[model samples]
Target chain A: MPSVKENTIVTTAAAVELRGLRKSYGEVVALANLDLSIEPGELIALLGPSGCGKTTALRTLAGFETTDEGKVLVDGDDITRLPANKRDMGMVFQAYSLFPNMTVLDNVSFGLRIRKANSAERTRRATELLELVGLPEHAARFPHQLSGGQQQRIALARALAIQPRVLLLDEPLSALDALVRVQLRDEIRRVQTELGITTLFVTHDQSEALSIADRVGVMYQGKLEQLAAPAELYSRPATAFVAEFVGTMNRLPGLMNGGTVTVAGRSLPVDGTAPASGSEVDVLVRPEAITLRPAEDGGGLIIATTFLGSVTRVRARLADGIEVSADLPSHQASALTAGTHVTLELDEQPVLVAAPLPR
Target chain B: MAQPVTARLGRGAAWAAFAAYFLVPMGASIYFTLFDRDNHFSATPYTGLFQASGFVPALQMSVEMGVLTVVVLLALLLPAMVTIQLSMPRLRPIVETLCTMPLVIPPIAFVAGIIALQTRLSDADPYGPLSQLVNNQLMQTGLPLLLVFSYVVLALPFAYRALDAGLRLLPLRTLVDAARGLGASWPTVLLRVIMPNLRTAILNAAILTLALVLGEFTLATLLGFTPFPVWIVTSGGDHAQQSTAASIVSLLVTWGGLLILSVFGDRRRTA
Candidate 1:
């Protein structure tokens, strides 16, 4: 594994910058003052649910979506007014827009052909790209002749053929089956790494964003809720939305006082500003963060258990019916049966707290 | 699972009915053209077709008119189509509505309107808008501009629909963005990426437009033009057999062009 230092050096040159970006269509605002800085050669995933504007943000960078306000700077040059065709950025669409009329080689070589590269060079480079994507054997086949995964790979190779300064992927894997999605995700990361191209990947899959991206930005309703490394995002999500979205979180209703939150008849230390004492708050704890043991006196009853290969996910309910989940090793899980009572140990570290829901 | 015999029989009866209705009329037309009342099959019409000198002039005029209609309409429509497509997305609905308006207005009414407008405009200025320099000289030469303009108006519905479908089916955003990003000017993108992708649609529309131009009647007649359709109609009373021969020849030519277009279009798409 490459060290974090190597990754940082490769990705920290400020490749693209978005400042106070805003876009609206009629009454619905798609992106609102989105500010982001992508480092050169970095692969950053913009993760969000549908309509969160992650795709919109990627399009804005690609110059497909015009920004109503704010400047988009690429390598310190403002390109906000630049037309999409002049942006010189490469993009792989979610639909894998490999030209159906062209063969895989022709599709991959389209950018070079458009730029008027010498025919020999175009063919040579296209062949290299097809090989890079592991589809050199399929070059003669038209787009319809290939599988969805193969088509997307060709799309990626085509985008890269231009040697674009920035690569934009808009939900590139969302259209693929699960197994192929994972396979292609890894392949994309490998290719991006090998080429050291600055890439902005948009996806709604948290696991994809975390596993493949050097950093993940969680977008919510056209605003970025948090942007951080995968571990930080999962372990220390910046907001309740981030915490719940990045991972499965069991939230407990609580009251905040100073740096502590009172939940389920127990007081726990928390970070960040707390509302006035007795004010409602939401305390989030990850399933893995909570430890469980068979309760001697039947305190916590197992309501549900899901075996997840190496680990077991236990959905338990307290006597008061507060549902909480715990992740235990497979061996530990095997010892516990349905209806088994368990004791809980919440991680000592503080969890994220947000304003409580109203009745 | 195999289809039931009853279903198969039902389908066979439907096909028989279809043959009786469609093939029967066509077969009768061919029979009438080939055989006389005595039921003797003679190649008289086919033999007479070669000696038919009426087709020479008519064929030349039809080809000239069709080519002129296509070149002029494409020169007018392509830019308009590109402009409408790449314009502000908000204005798309309005542009689309305007483009489709010609379809709703009947061709006869459209030609009438064009003639009336041309007369009104020409009367207001004897040189006919650009007539000042040349005066009545240009008008005397018989400009087919207005005639072709009417044809374009008639053809706009199919042309616009085809072009719109082409633009919609294309990965337009990526194409535009890729071009612009690469520092290609708007003109370059319009000429390069947009035009290449639109070849099939443009060809199909142009072929259909050519067919429309070749077969058009009311507009050419109203405008006092000697185009094929008007000639064919006027020739009908003088020689019914000659008119039938002309119609068959024109149909074959038109069908040939359509066949070529369909084959090429299919190949281009699948290639």
Candidate 2:
């Protein structure tokens, strides 16, 4: 284990600092000038689809991959040229990569053994770590003897055994089933908080990122679209891609006339600057942000209805044959079947508006 | 349960055939050595058994040379196999071909060439550097180098295959990565993980080398080296009783070595 000064502030410490990080493989650019700064004692989730450079960033920080350009500073020191072993960073692989030949205790104490810790102290620490991961009785079993979830937990404990400054997780829960994933996610969060270790979690699941991260960075096309608190990101997306990727957004192709937008043959009030008149633009509205009401005299009809326990989603077709999806509270939802006459009400202001692309 | 008569008759015939295959040779050899009417245990024909002659010296020389051959073969082959596998994965076929080359070359043909060269050089200038080195050190060391070279040639196939199988079974990448991630240097990783994981391979190859060393006679005879098999052959033709005794002794030694190898050679590689 590394020794830290007693007078240093632990929480506000910046453990990982990446500046102009760039990596590419032949003709494909994996990471194009990625810059990210992570603070100590904070769990930041890197959420993106496959090939979005999330894993590349984590590997760079762990010193597993070399940066084509720029530097990686850890604990206020540049580690651009250091090897992975000397980086003192704990990493949990996507596959529960436990050493299959060793028992759980030995796997957990591998780092300590390499550091030449005493036998008694190493055993005691390893046992405590196993107990911390809720596997106190499984210390004697080999990795193959355990289930997938148990193996992941053991991998986690083995990573934490070294007490590293930063914990890097590469989709650690992706291999487990849904129920075990949720269970292990909570346990990982709890352990992270208990240990107060700076961790970078990479995942493709939006809900998992939104639920577990203190602040989530939404990545797309090798660049971060937005990095903010989860609530802020969901409530106010920074870009059109962020809005569509982070949550469900019904983008309505519309025309900007003066300060108001016309979409689906209906005029909606805009809260932001409207594009030039007659310019093609897209009007973004979330499902829950729009409201539906029974309007028999109106020109729209409900084409489909999906009941989701708490809220009912209604897909209504306008007079111009464009479909608009809106969510209604279950209690306030009308008993409107498919192909029933209805009307949408613009019940909320501050609607997100974006410019449309050229045809 | 009731048995069929035809099956019983077939089984009895199979047993008779098996008995004739293995037991007849032992019976004939024992009969020839102990109760042959031609020699009748006469002291005159048993002149080779006298310790004052060349028999004891040859026996001692063969035992010493066989042990040295086994040791040198193992020492040279283990590290060579490991280094070739670790450093040059692409050259594996070439290395394997070289390791197995001795199997295809006839021992007599190989030793014939060696003897031809040695005689040519010895006649040209016995006091030259090459002749002096060979005669002074290699030949005069009781043919130790020749015996060791013979053992290596005979044992290469077994050693290479065993170590190659071990290398395949070992989780080399995981072990190397684990050691490196724990701040261990390359030498430490090789010593701690690589060597220990190859224990079974080394033991199996050692036992195989020992067997080949003890049983090899063609190469030893061609090279004029005193290996156990050559000694046994010389002793056998001299006196039937002493030759049977030496055969039993060699058989016991081979069996003991195999027993030790089997006992300790069962190992599972760990990452």
Candidate 3:
């Protein structure tokens, strides 16, 4: 990997601020007063399901969509009304978007050509970008000759050619196969960090966002439900939606007593805000947080076991008819099979307690 | 793999149908053009077509009009369609409907409307400036310019369909947005970015327009113009063999032009 100084365009990255961004089409509200702030050189991923306003916010910041009411500030300058061409922001769409008529080298140098850079300078910068993207040998080839991964890499290089102040990636790797998606996702993170350019990545893939972003902002119904670091978002999600969306969270009926929630006859301390005492609540627990012990007359029945390489996932139906899954070391779950009797025990950890859904 | 018996039979039947529909008529035309009086095969009719009076001039006029009509059609439709696609997409169906209107209006009816309008303008007061200009010698001499305009209308449906289908195959909105995002102006986006990508579509539209103009006869003859098709029909009055020979030559030219265009289109797409 190249050092930060090798291809860094800006010594200090720009800070981006999106405030009160609201957009609607007829009676449908795409974005409802969404606000977000990014520190300089930080990569923030707006993670959500489809139609969650994650893309709308990114487009508004890129100047592709005009917000009905909002302000987009980069480095303290308002660029809300600026046309997309003048925004000086690099964007990679879900599609390749590489100009089909041009070679890979020409596609990378397109922005420079539009900026009136001389031919020699264009070639030099374009060559440098191709090298950065690890496609220096394929520069002479047109887009059609390249694979989906290579095309997206070239697209990233092309967007970075102009050295824009900010980088906006809209699900840039969603179109690729699974293996390529992971490889390119890591490469993008490396490139972004090396350049230290503030970036906003919008994606519906929770794992992609969690694994790459400095902060993952979970969006739901045109609003940011929670924004935190990956570990923090996973370990301590601010809301039930975030907890359910980021990773698998088992919802088990529990009784809240004071600051603790009793689940499966075990009282576990609550994290964040706990529900009122003596009120029924749904306790959310991570799969890995649950442990199983075989017993001659246990109340839990192992419904199924799935081998996941390093870890084995065991699904158990409790005596109360609630199903919960547990991920244990393969060796630990090797003897457990369907119909095995086991006692489910909660690990001593902070669990979230929320009001049960209204029937 | 060996073909199934039923599939082979179906394929054979299709080939026989194709030969009967296309090859038979083409062979008859060639045979008629080659054979002369007393059933003697001779090249005189084919060679004598060039010697016929007004034949060369009519051919030249038709070629010129074909090229002009293609140029005019492209100039008017390309930008208009691109603009509508990029900015006012809601107007696309309306524009398509209007372009196809020429297909529903018969050529004879359209020519009658044009002649009626011309006669009304011609009979206006001579001292009136518009009437004087309309009756001028230059206007009378350039009456064939009206044929170019009418040809453009006639070619609209084919041109629009070709270009529209081509646009559908492309990520047009993304291309435009990418170009504009790279700081390209609208004209630069259209010409440098959009048009180059649409090479095959533009070629198809131009070929369609050229073919339509070259083969058109009714409007040209009724409007008192002597294009190639009209000349072929007129020559048949006194020389039937020569007319068939000219028709065969025109058919070859049209087929050759289309073949070259398709080859060029394929090469560009691969390139």
Best-matching candidate per TM-score: 3
User: lDDT of each structure?
Assistant: 0.79, 0.76, 0.89
Give model 1's DockQ, 2 decimals. 0.42
Candidate that beats the other on TM-score, 2 or 3, i.e. the better one: 3
Candidate 3 residue lDDT tens string, B1-271: 9999999999999999988999899899889878765788988778887788989889988898889898889889988998898789999999999999999998889999988866766776654777757545323433367788889999999999999988988898888878877788888898888889989999989988888888898988888888999999998998898898898888998999889988987887798
Each candidate's interface RMSD: 3.1, 3.5, 0.9
Measured against the true structure, the TM-scores of the candidates, in listed sequence, are 0.88, 0.71, 0.90
lDDT of 3 at B146: 76
Q: Tell me which residue pairs clash in candidate 2.
A: none
| Each model's DockQ score | 0.42, 0.24, 0.62
- Relative to the unseen true structure, what is the C-alpha lDDT of residue B2 in candidate 3, on a scale of 0 to 100? 95
Give every collision pair in model 1. A84-B177, A85-B177, A85-B179, A85-B180, A85-B181, A86-B180, A86-B181, A87-B180, A87-B181, A88-B181
Give the least accurate 10-residue stretch of model 1 chain B, judged by summed lDDT: B132-141
Candidate 2, after superposition: displacement of residue A7 in Å? 20
lDDT of 3: 0.89
Q: Fraction of true inter-chain Cα contacts (below 8 Å) kept per model?
A: 0.41, 0.25, 0.55
Residues A69-88, model 3: lDDT tens digits: 98999999999999999988
For residues B42-92, write the lDDT of model 1, one tens digit per residue. 766656765665555655666766777777777787777666666667677
Better of 2 and 3 by DockQ: 3
CAPRI docking class of candidate 2: acceptable
Compared with the true structure, what per-residue lDDT tens digits does model 2 show for residues A138-188? 988988789999998988888888777788888989989999999999989
